[model samples]
Target chain A: MHEASAATAPGRGGRDLAISVRDLVVGFGDTLVVRGLDLDVYRGEVLGFVGGSGTGKSVLTRTILGLERKRSGRIEVFGEDLDKASAADHARIERRMGVMFQQGALFSNLTVKQNIQVPMREHLRLSPRFADELAMLKLALVGLDLDAADKLPAQLSGGMIKRAALARALALDPELVFLDEPTSGLDPIGAADFDELIATLQKTLGLTVFMVTHDLDSIYAICDRVAALAEGKVIAAGPISTLLASDHPWVHAYFHGTRARRFQDVQ
Target chain B: MEIPDGPTFKSSRSRDAITFELAGRWTIGASAALEDGARAVFAEASKVRRAVLDLGAVAALDTAGAWLIDKTRRELAAAGVEARLERVRPEYGILLEEAHYRQFEAPSGKRRLYAAVLLADIGESVVSFGKDVLAGVSFLGEVVASLLGTIIAPLRFRAISLVFHIEQIGFRSVPIIGLINFLVGCIVAQQGIFQLQRFGASTFAVDLIGILVLRELGVLLTSIMIAGRSGSAVTAEIGSMKMREEIDALKVMGLRPVEVLIVPRILALVISLPLLTFIADMAALFGGLLVAWGYGGINPAAFMARLQSAIGENTFLVGIIKAPFMALVIGIIASMEGLAVAGSAESLGRRVTASVVKSIFMVIVLDGFFAVFFAGIRY
Candidate 1:
């Protein structure tokens, strides 16, 4: 495990960090959701966030994306302070980051091809034919055939929907990708396959993946480091093995439990 | 603080009736104070049948201050006393003319009648007719598209899903529509009986109930009920879906919310409404038949014969024709209100209420327009 950590050392040393969140805090009305959390996602490393329900993992991701305003914080994505960023700056940052939501979140009425072409249409100056070809490429990259591109979201099964959404997310060849609950609601075999896909894509594209998930198998299989959130704070963060070895009861229970043990056996 | 120089008035009969000059920025509150002062000054001037206010020295008097003096003068005139204004400022005089202050000088009885008629017309035409026509046309277009989309979709799975929505919106809605239609039939029959009995024409109550329920009340009542029930549900469903990011998901993937979700729901309602209204008409007639046989001592067979004679096929058709239009309005308005919902659960609640109230109000108003149109036709 330590050797694995050393082998995945931060990434290209001279390149800047992809995302930096320092002493971040977020609240909904009177209740604080995320509190004084710090994290650094270096360029070209898949950083995973894992926690129990209501641990503010999703809220932290939303804050970093500028979708949710932080109460007090500094969030610099590619050296830009997203906290105080203008709409144009936010647009610039968004152009560089791709997001795949849970449930695939595909539009029910549009064909998968149109869905994949959305970012390309918005951020790139490609002709319709060129955009169609690019969408086909993305669909193929996600292991989907071109026939799947013309189908609506409602036509696809759960696994296919997730893959279609991923194809759309990668439409812009984004530097950073945020995956929220990527393996949620999938059967174990399906989830494992998706984890493999994410790992394969990360390596081939040299993309940084910042994923928020509770799926332990996904964390173990794909993530270079795990950030565990609890009670609005980061209780543990670093290599997955370091988190598993921590004295914290939640950490021990999370990484050495029945689910984790089964996942390790599969690996 | 020295007051800016303006109008001055003096009552010759009273030493205490001291009127000060008026000048710049005399807004509503300042005018109110001036009126209070004038009223106080007049309290001691009972013997003085007339008083004159001179405005030659006034630079400007705001609209409210001018209105105050106008009102005071009218009150004095109503008591068979006289008050006059002399040398009023041109700008203030123009303001008074625009507000129609001179109308206060008219004979009280005539003014009262005119005001009553005008108020009634505004209530009927602007508030009722204008809002209904606008809401109805837009809703009609939306409902038609929605219903057609749902009914004609190629996918069997989607069509099956729509069956559940139909059962929820259509079949479950029948009981409420039936109950309301029955009550409406009984009320109309009862009212007809009371009015006709004065002329020993009680049996004609059957004819009236037959025509009213089959030709109008049944459709109107069903539409109102469904608009309240189904329209509000659509608004809340879409509004919550919007808040939950479901609608945003469609937009992110370049899908139109209207073409996808709204069209289907609207279509379902449009197709369901006429059918529901037909059921309501039958239910209402059943209620009327019970009333005729039990309370009015008319045989059920005899009542049916008279009802059939009085309500022609054209009458029934007219009511049925109005059903789809009413349904269209309800669906579109509800969906529009839902899509318009903002950031909170409270917005969902507000939009639901607005959808229901607006749909019901528009349905009744459109019913009146159809009535007028049919009545005006020479055929």
Candidate 2:
């Protein structure tokens, strides 16, 4: 419902934002990777975050997840300021969100079903039977067969690994999910199917999806909106059409680039 | 749904048709009663031609309840009884459908291995052991070549990383090594005193502690401790780097992983082992001195004089001389295991454990060889 450019004032749109980052500066030692960056992800929208390699897209996502410390900034999630929240409130906020890391970050020691059950067991108390059943349900929900439930992450193919990780992300039935390069390793068909799956899941569950990706097909096919990052700042944010018309140099080159041409207007 | 106090079932028979009415909670909290009731009803229901299970009165349902219903239906079907479950709420229907989809298979029996399989495993292990030995020899050659190169061009050495590793494996480990050696010294003196007192030679405990601490225990214990503590850490660090492809990344950047990472760590261990052994030796002697005087009634002067006579320069030199070789064994074994790590957490753990075990085993064997060689030369 809310559509705005990257330079637009924060909280100006009518619809609520799931994640709001302002003046976020993250650095390691003397080098600044993300400086004075601002990002907004509106509720129930799949926001595809695009950037060149080593442009700090993963760093920014990690900062939002509280994995990396920010030099200076304020981050808000679900209407609560992250910096000022108490420990309990922080945990509550964390419980409402799920993350599927790029490598799937699956617990190698656990079976796929057990991995899905981890979030369920950590945040809720239920009988082991019910937990296992729910884990199977989640596995099925992610389009994995029942046999995949008993297999370890090491035993899965790349696409299966992504699906299993997605299943684990949806285990707790969170309102928000963060996916990093979810389809990077998959084949074209697998990647397209995955994008379709994510779109369906987002629409059905009313999830606020924050996806960091490099796949042009993914941005064009499923993302309700796209934000472009360059030189430690978000230079553009809008729908695919808006990004195509942008005059910024990096945005122009990225969207109209040779590799991106095939995917442009495919949606 | 609130769980009923207990699950109970009532059954009625009308000639060929049998109806079993299930009531109360069938969730996990009342699982025992639910199982019993289901078993009792199903056992008799199988005798009937037509069996119907009514669940309309059930107050609560979970995976456990669905499992019970599923199991009963399965058992009845197995008995050739035409059974039907009715009055299921749609909310609970999904639970039942999911339960039906997830029917757990019985675990397969334990693996039964044939003689060929056993023999193949042994052969594989022997071949792997041979490969490990070859790899170790080659790795040592590479390290020595790198060391020689650094010696020829001293600026090529990574002094900062070397210092960091030295501080990690040596300086930070002093307190623990000192305490363990000191305690070993005290225990040896106490036991020697207790045994020698029978022969009225309680003061001879000084000679026992002196010879053992100076000649064997000091270097051996220090080597063992380092193998367990720093050896495992080295393997884990390098193994993790290998697992994450950082070593490959270094190779891509036109750097040899051995020269950058392995050389600094091994050099640190080799250089610091003797220094650590010296500290352990001193702490052990001090501890023995205290126990000798306090427990054996040997005055400090007498104990010191006896210590000087009981062990000669060669005794001290024998332990100190073995420190570098022991350090080399630990460093080489640890780094070799780390480099051999595959891409898995399990592999890293296995490699680390093997590094410690193999280094300690080889160190003790090397010590035995040293003992024999030293005796041959009468050192």
Candidate 3:
């Protein structure tokens, strides 16, 4: 854990910090969802963001992705402050990042292959044949059957939808990827396979993954760091060992819960 | 290093085969020229029994190049030509292999447009319509039973929902219905005056507008408008709720969605359509009276007197009588289509359209039945 932190220190690895959020406050009406939150996600590491249901983990992720308006905050991605970036610069930064929203959020109108090709077509000028071939390759990369390319999102199983969404997220060869509840609906084997794919892709593609999840097994198995969000703040941020030994009441209870204990047994 | 001439191909006919030399960067960046070249090659290859594509001189290749190569081979193979690629780069092999295996040939040549198939389709539609009618009748029975149950236990009735629907379907529709009926009434009066003036009996124009507006147009137009406007809205609202699984949620909570959602909406339509028709009748008569005074130079008093004698109490009652039935048809069809929505936006759209169309058709048909029945009774 110390070595991982050392590797991510400011002077190392040509912009080691991929995303740095500071003093962030997000709210809807009178309810404060994320408040006084400060977090950093290093480049080329998978950061698993965990929270109890309705703890605003997804909200915070959306705020960083520029989907949700923040009451007050400073969010920087790849050394460019999002608030100060111009529209063109913001679009450029956005093009370099990908997001796989929960429930896949696949365009119900498009086939799986067309869904993968959409971002590529928008961002890169390529012939239809190249786009088609690339879409097929991505389908293979995500472990979906080649024939699944022509199927609509409605025709796909829950696991296939997630894989297709992941394939789209990787289509642009993005440096940073945001995955919200990527493995929530999958069975154990499917979830583990998804986790392995993410890990392998992160290593091979050198992607910085900011994942929002409640899957303890995924956090334990693949995440390089885990950030626990509670009480409108990230109360603990470190490796799994650090979170397990934390004194924070919510963090301790979460890591020591029966479900966590079962997962811990196998680990 | 750029490919200055783009991708170029040189083809020549041998004794019984065509040998093509493919060169240059056959990639996406030079897609247009490469596509043209491929087209020319395929066109020339049709005359040969076999073709050899030599790629040894090709500068580079990617997935785009591989797709082109694979497409060319497939096209030739389809034309009964055995096409072979010589000196294929190892980098292009995996892509060509993958692309070749996942053939994009649509399930072909199986669609035969036979008269029997057309007949089968018509029969299928008839059977489907029968099922829909059965479903709608059963749903109407269910709603009636629930209405009776609610009457027995007044506390179980959703009075607020009933009021809201009444406001939505009835109150919101008053101005537009009034305007349309008023315009239609004026047109009818002006046309009657114009034709009757030729016969030196222009005073009889008032009779034409009065009987038509009171006996038929009032209820028919109002019902059609209501079916188009509020009926479509009802189907879309309920269909969306069904799509989002809210209907199932209502069921799990021990509430009958038909009673809670459908009954109130149908009751509102039934209660409002007759009132709207009555209002439309009055508006149409007023418009006709205005045209009679202005266009035909008849006094308002004379017009009112003519209208009074030409349209009897039963004439107005005849139109009002059909209003509730039309309302029931629209309400029943809309709710049936709404509840029938499957798990897609397309289905919701289709059901909404079918609801309005079926309701309007049935409304006009019901009006015809009422017309015949009233004439038989000498009303």
Candidate 4:
């Protein structure tokens, strides 16, 4: 419990922070979705971001990725202040980061192979032979067959879309990855397989993963640290054990509720 | 942390044996350097009988890094040099094993070009055209069966659906259709007057406008306009519904989507096209009359007398007779395209385009056939 008292101050990791957001105020129209929020995502750890529906879990993630505007805030990725970054600096920071949107968001007209090559073509100048082989290597890393490369996104099943999206996100070998609701629509077995895959990738690639999720099983399975967002702010940020020990009414209730029995089963 | 430098290697050789020590990021960002280094390794390893790739000093590794290293190793082995990896981190080892060197053969669909290819293309287009006709006929049979079933069990007929679609397809189309027909009528009358006046037969322009407006142009224009507007709308709606599996959802619930979706729309078209054609005819005649009085110096009464004498009752009936068939062609084509929608937004767009273009072409073709039939019967 004492560890959470100053948790919002960020960075028990000190100089190793992958993402540091301070006093972030994000809103749409008159309604403030994320108000006065502060959070930290340290390097080389899987941070699971959880919030109730419409609580702006996605908004905050999008804000950090610069996909959404913030009314007032300071955001830093890999020690480069987002607001202060020059265009070139921003591109530099962006090239090392990847995002897998909630829906696959693959180009509807492109085959999966072309979809994977889009970012590679943008940022790297590789011979087409090397590019093709690299794309196949990525496809295999995410457990997709090379045959699926010629198919369009519409031809893929829901679970395959997730995997393909993940493959595209990893196309650049990004050090930091944002995954939004990675296991929401997947069946239980599929979700478990996905959780294991994420765990393996995070470990082997040394990737810093920031996942926004409502899947309790995913939270229990792979998240190295869990951040609970409520009231337009992060109420608690720590490991699963630390969150379970907190006495805040919502945090206590959410982690110990009937649904949390699954957490119990996980333990 | 500072950006790591590109991959570099230190190699040592002693009598038929060589060790290449690799270092640096070896990530995709350093791909160019990695390629040069791999080339350097291959050039050195070919002269030796045995080769070893040591990765103990590498700072970072990704699939691309692993792949490049594995490629060099395979290139050496293929050149008859015994090669293997050494001191690789377990994670890099797994990455290497996963992205092991393999050849991806391009599909063998490329055939040599020939004049026969042109003939083949023509044959394919003809076959596809035949398939489209067959598909349309089958779709027509299904709708007819549903229409008959509804007729036999009148209690199950969807009257409200028919009326609702009539409003969407016909009532909403009136303003644009009327305005365009009026403008077209004015243009045709002005052109007729200009051409005929040079021949000292300017008053004959009145008869031309009367017969053309009453018999052919009015209904054809109305049908073409509707095909672009409401026909496209119907195809888009049904195509999107099919994309989302809503059509299949209705079938699983034991409801015939053809009865619920296609029949009412087609019936509404059948009921609405003639009424719209009548509107188009009157609007165009009014426009032609105004032009005749203003531009051709024909008084209102003179123009009215000439128009009444030039157009017969059969002339009006002949134009209205084509309306229902035009409606059927548009409805059948639009509905068939909608049902054929596969699971993509691009497919929906393509189906809507095909619906509009095919229906308009078929409308013109059907009108030509009717013209030939009426001429044969001397109607």
Question: Judged by lDDT, which candidate is best?
Answer: 4
Model 3 segments beyond 4 Å from truth? Answer: A1-15, A23-37, A52-55, A69-74, A81-91, A125-127, A230-233, A263-267, B1-127, B141-168, B171-205, B244-246, B249-260, B290-299, B372-379
Q: Report per-candidate DockQ.
A: 0.01, 0.07, 0.10, 0.57
Report lDDT (Cα) of residue B184, candidate 1.
77
Best by TM-score: 4
**Of 2 and 4, which scores higher on TM-score?**
4
lDDT of 1 by residue, B1-379 (tens): 2244323344445443333333343322232345444465455333366656556655445333455566566766676556667777655676455322333121133445878898998788777657756765676666556546645865512455456667878899988888888877777777787788899887899888877887788888889889888999999999999989899999999866776777667767888899999999988888888877777777888887888778788878888999988987798789888987876566788889989998998899889888888889821
Clashes of each: 4, 0, 0, 0
Better of 2 and 3 by TM-score: 3
On lDDT, the stronger of 2 and 4 is: 4
DockQ of 4: 0.57
TM-score of each: 0.47, 0.66, 0.75, 0.91
- Stretch of 10 with least lDDT, candidate 2 chain A: A1-10
For each candidate in turn, give its C-alpha RMSD to the true structure in angstroms: 26.3, 7.9, 7.0, 3.1
In candidate 4 chain B, what residue range of length 10 has the lowest lDDT sum? B104-113
Q: How would you class the docking of model 3?
A: incorrect
lDDT of 1: 0.74
TM-score of 2: 0.66
Among residues 3 or more apart in sequence or in different chains, the pairs in candidate 3 whose N, CA or C atoms overlap within 3 Å are none
Report the C-alpha lDDT of model 3 over A141-234, residue by residue, as the tens digit. Answer: 6789988888999899999999999999877667799999999999999999999988877765567999999998899889988999998888
Tens-digit per-residue lDDT, A32-100, candidate 4: 999999888888999999988898999999899888999998888987789999999999899899999
